[model samples]
Target: MSREFLPGQVIVYPYLWAWQHERGETEGRKTRSTSVVVAVRGANDGLTHLALLAITTQPPEPDRIALEVSDIECRRAGLSDFKRCWIVVDEYNYDVAERSWYIEPDEPALGRFSKAFMMRIAAAFGQASRKSGRRVNRTE
Candidate 1:
């Protein structure tokens, strides 16, 4: 809650909390969720907020549009052992916490998507939003 979050940064948060509230289900315990920050801005109340897309090692569903991240990029973003990763572009959350991010090595916010890749993500998000009438939602 005290640190700043930037777009393109990879972060993990207490997704079990949201899952519990939204679906009343989790893996029988708290589990963290990883996402890539897409945007950051100050809100009316003067709080910093973030927009993010879910990241996963799992192969995305056929209906989902995803960007492939290389192993080097994955390591830079606090993920390792995976030679590749995917960032889902169809849906994302907005106005989430600016802090409480997690990394396995406790490294200094090392996970970040490259500027070029981030631009691609933004473009994809725009296309999907325009076609599907989807908008980023503030985290609950």
Candidate 2:
């Protein structure tokens, strides 16, 4: 597995959302651009754990938390096709790099967000995580 699990890196993934899983869906309905918000290697398992946030052109639902992506930031993140978009922060898809069947190791990343913008995203994610946030485990 040669995929780079770095913060801010955007990659295409079949991201199963918490709600979808709750509905007994085993896979994402579609492949979409997802941001690698966090990546930590477990000492015992030696696997890279990843937290992926979905990137969408549609605005988030009223109850969900999100951060708007600017034109420059979108371009930097290889999202120029989206004139407007937001990063959903209220929840994430969790996966182990070594065990994941959805993340393609040979695929190239779409792009990366700037450190500053990523910091903002991280902060929002942290805050949302402390609230009614949800996680969808893709490993199962």
Candidate 3:
């Protein structure tokens, strides 16, 4: 994890840990990619767990949902270019905050999406859950 973020928020992150417990964990380089914070749960062990839904500039695939954000919103969120994003609702990941180098809250933040957008995300998540026949947990 390269950047720390709260649940329900959005951020322009630069890398992905690409962790696969079966294979191993491989880290991504410093590259910008958009991700939605799904949760920040605290374990009984006192470690914070982070989950995120990764969004991308790539076109929406079969199960992915498109997210609409305005130009001003994109700029405010620290995107390097125009908005061309989609959500990968079928998949998500979790890690510890200690593994992240999060942009401080005081920094120019990418903040959470609007209520409307969040509602859409939640709805998409539900649909995805049904499509895959798995319960979608850890929603914000």
Q: TM-score of each candidate?
A: 0.70, 0.97, 0.60
**Candidate 1 positional error at 52, Å:** 1.3
Candidate 3: list runs displaced more than 4 Å: 1-4, 14-25, 63-76, 101-108, 133-140
- Across 1-140, the per-residue lDDT of candidate 1 in tens digits comes to 55666667876643332334356453224333355545455556565665567676779778777788777778767778666678777666555454323323343464777787778878887787677523334443
TM-score of 1: 0.70
> Which pairs of residues clash in candidate 2, taking residues 3 or more apart in a chain or in different chains?
none
lDDT of each residue in 1-140, candidate 2, tens digit only: 76668999999999888898899999999999999999999999888999999998888889889999999999998999998999999999999988989988788989999999999999999999999789998988
lDDT: which candidate is best?
A: 2
lDDT assessment of candidate 2? 0.92
59: Cα error in model 1, Å = 1.1
Between prediction 2 and prediction 3, which has the larger lDDT?
A: 2
Residue-level lDDT for 77 in candidate 1: 74
Off by over 4 Å in 1: 15-33, 98-110, 133-138
lDDT by residue (tens digit), candidate 3, 37-124:
4555466755556556666677765544555555654554455375556556655554455545543334434556656666676777
Q: Give, for candidate 2, the lowest lDDT window spanning 10 residues.
A: 1-10
Question: Which ten contiguous residues of candidate 3 have the minimum total lDDT?
Answer: 131-140
